[model samples]
Target: MDPSSVIWIFFVFLFFYPQVLFRYRLLQRYKFIKQFEAVRKTRAIVMIHRQEQLALFGIPLYKYITIEDSEEILRAIRMTPEDMPIDLILHTPGGLVLASEQIAIALKEHKAKTTVIIPHYAMSGGSLIALAADEIIIDKNAVMGPVDPQIGQYPAASIINAINTKYTDELDDETLILGDIARKAIVQVKEFVYDILKDKMGEEKAKYLSETLSTGKWTHDYPLTINKLKDLGIEVNTELPNIVYELFDLYRQPVNQRPSVQYVPVPYKRGTKK
Candidate 1:
């Protein structure tokens, strides 16, 4: 190896070896094990940051809801030694509904109260999990989405292109394939929308919400804001979840900043009247 390359490697190992060990958690394994035992003994709130894990073409796939580097969490969940009050802090754009539902059922079955704290956003399938929680705490501006499952083709621009092709240039047999695909895409979108109807708001409303969101009913829009969750009876408030307490209060915090608490009509206190 070149002498410069060898020297660089030595400096890298010296400077970054500790960080590598920490990231992999090799250095603190024993200490963490002991602390894990202690935390399990007390009724401490369990904090899990389920950020993006799965994506498709830059879009968050619902299936990424699975826990990664979550053996500690899995162990904690399985530790039935004592009852520990838990709070799940979720900030997701929504992925797979079932993955979220499992976490919801697990939290609800174990603790006395499983409050889902939406520090920033809990949308799509994430919203479904929030619905399962006993209490949902979110800032007034904190968003939760339409629960109206989106089932549609992306870039509806493709459909537009196909139409233009047929009109502008003489479309051949492949155009026939596009015709069939576009038709089926519409039907697939409808079927998915219909299925979601059966799950939420009963058959009638699910059907309506699905159809409404899919078609031009509500106007095809993305990035629906926090205001809509307010309309859905979710108590949007400025209350802080327990995780935020530790983030600002404790030393060596991981997250950059606490979510901005937005004031809304919903009451943050336990007994306050709406």
Candidate 2:
């Protein structure tokens, strides 16, 4: 072939290869999910967000739970039979309160058993949705964070603290306003958390969990380990299904993206050094 023809063919392969691979992966994921549903006899739903570059712009975008996510999840829940169980695989850093609450409330109202499996971490709003589940299945190393409300970039509790620590006259008008809104946000989220947990556990335990998770005692990104959760009477199961890890593998990081962490893909025995 002429050099010009060869160059054209290479460009075509580069452009078409990714598209073909993406479609194949999508189909494979669908098949795997269907098989999982069949084995578990439940409706399988996944809410995962990864930092990926846009196709046209190639600019990396961070993802969080959005209203669109809630809409789709709610629709899936509605389509499921009332008697069918739901398996929600959540991997998120968290998102909009309204969106998260919408999803949590719908899951709470589901007639069948609801299970949330966290293969890695489900922080903030993600943790809120987990509270509504009948069971939380998480990897032993996985973490969940406080559901404390964040006013803009600041934590609600911190905003309130700033106002209280300094006199009203010392604070800026906007700071004072944020403080007031922060207090209200805390109460609203605490109540919502209680509502989701009340029926699952008794009212007392529910209240405790609600306050602990939503009152902003810890930083927004504070990691709540399985042990800590269990200590708080969360009854979290650490026996995460192998298929869940497999499913997560399908939602891999974008191609051509560099990974910061790398290690041999094998389990190492204790006291064995590489």
Candidate 3:
């Protein structure tokens, strides 16, 4: 071939190579987005606190529920039609009290039935959210936990009890103030729990369960098994649906891997740069 013809061919390859690569990346992203939308359309809302999804600099994110998370959940609820049933998949160590309450209330107020599926554990605030569900489905090995409120890192009940035991001279202003706040928090949390349970269980039964869960009788992190929950008048299903396990499988992470950034290319418009 002529040298000029060879040079023209090379220029064309250089011009089109990046465009080809960009299109391939765009196609992959489009496929992933479609799959995600399909899953959302299934009416399953998952709140799994997986280490991979929540880790930052080796620290676990969402050790407590956040206000931002409540907003995201609200958005998801908005996307769901009022007549559609909601299936909530919960696996978390729990988080902020107010944040949890927001999500719990939203779930409770949903027009259609809401079912909570616990494949493993839903502790603390997670338990609070579970209480709002119309039905709870759990595996035999799954656990729910006490709904006692925690102020900062200290359990509210413990803080109040400590104040009662300690002499006035031994307690500083900060300690006294915290104890007062904890006392009020304990009452507030019990009220919230009662409200969450009142519609499913009667008011009296809800009150009893709320008192039992919030007074720290079994400790804050006490794991309530299926039998215990049944005794408490909660309708607990020992058999978890296959879809719950499949969801967990999708979110599972490999052991010993650090969190990393992920990038997906956006499809370019026809008139956009290569």
Q: Name the best candidate (by lDDT).
A: 2
Q: For model 2, where is the 10-residue window of minimal lDDT?
A: 258-267
lDDT of 3 by residue, 179-234 (tens): 99998998999999998888778899999999999988888888899889888888
**Candidate 2 lDDT (Cα, 0 to 1):** 0.84
User: Candidate 3 clashing pairs?
Assistant: 64-95, 65-95, 65-96
The residue-by-residue lDDT of candidate 2 on 18-98, one tens digit each, is 878776766667777777776777778888877888877989888898888888888778777677788998999999999
Point out the higher-scoring one by lDDT: 1 or 3: 3
TM-score of each predicted structure versus truth? 0.49, 0.89, 0.75
lDDT ranking from best candidate downward: 2, 3, 1
Query: Candidate 2 clashing pairs?
Result: none
Backbone clash count, each prediction separately: 3, 0, 3
**Candidate 1 ranges beyond 4 A from true positions:** 1-11, 14-63, 67-75, 80-83, 150-227, 241-274
RMSD of each: 10.6, 9.1, 9.7
